[model samples]
Target: MSKASRYEWRDQQASLQERMKGFMENPGTEQLQAVLTEMHAYAAAAQDGSIDIPERFIAFS
Candidate 1:
């Protein structure tokens, strides 16, 4: 890349790194459900409005 472009990217690199660090520290709610389907955890419940997970699993996540 050109020098000017490289310098611009360098500035963004720190911001990207900090965002990644925050993600690594805590995955949050997104980690719990990977997708939107009956096969996945929440999706199955959404279809029939029935709760599926056990109380212990809630705490574990």
Candidate 2:
């Protein structure tokens, strides 16, 4: 993808995170754990090359 597109995806992910924060504002402990588990899966997928992280994230390195 183009650099601009990568940036856009990164922005979208950030926006998703913000939205999730609101959705989870009063989540129970189990719900919080589930969110964390999903996040870990997302990270693992990215690390395993099963998912492609946006260039903006790569650029952070």
Candidate 3:
């Protein structure tokens, strides 16, 4: 990629890392639980064929 593009990508990555670090330092437990619950629902849907995961996708974490 061009120099300008690389710099922009690096800036975005750095910003995301900082945000994640803050979240790790102070997690919102309720929010995290809600998201995990939603993800489980999606996994269930995929398993039951109500929705489909991409072929060759590995097991969900």
How do the residues 7-48 of candidate 1 rate in per-residue lDDT, one tens digit apiece? 444454444455555556777655323222213433444355
Q: Worst ten-residue run, lDDT, model 3?
A: 52-61
Candidates' C-alpha lDDT:
0.43, 0.63, 0.54
1-61: candidate 3 lDDT, tens digit per residue: 4556455544544454555565567789754565556556655755775543333424354
What value of lDDT does candidate 1 attain over all alpha carbons? 0.43
Q: What is the lDDT of candidate 3?
A: 0.54
Residue 2's lDDT in candidate 2 = 64
Candidate 2: tens digits of C-alpha lDDT, residues 2-58: 666565556646655754685578677766766676577667766776545654434
**TM-score of every model versus the real structure:** 0.37, 0.51, 0.46
In order of TM-score, best first, we have 2, 3, 1
Candidate 3 segments exceeding 4 Å error: 29-61
User: What C-alpha root-mean-square deviation, in Å, does candidate 2 show against the real structure?
Assistant: 5.4
Residue 33 lDDT (model 2): 69
Model 2 is weakest, by summed lDDT over 10 consecutive residues, at 52-61
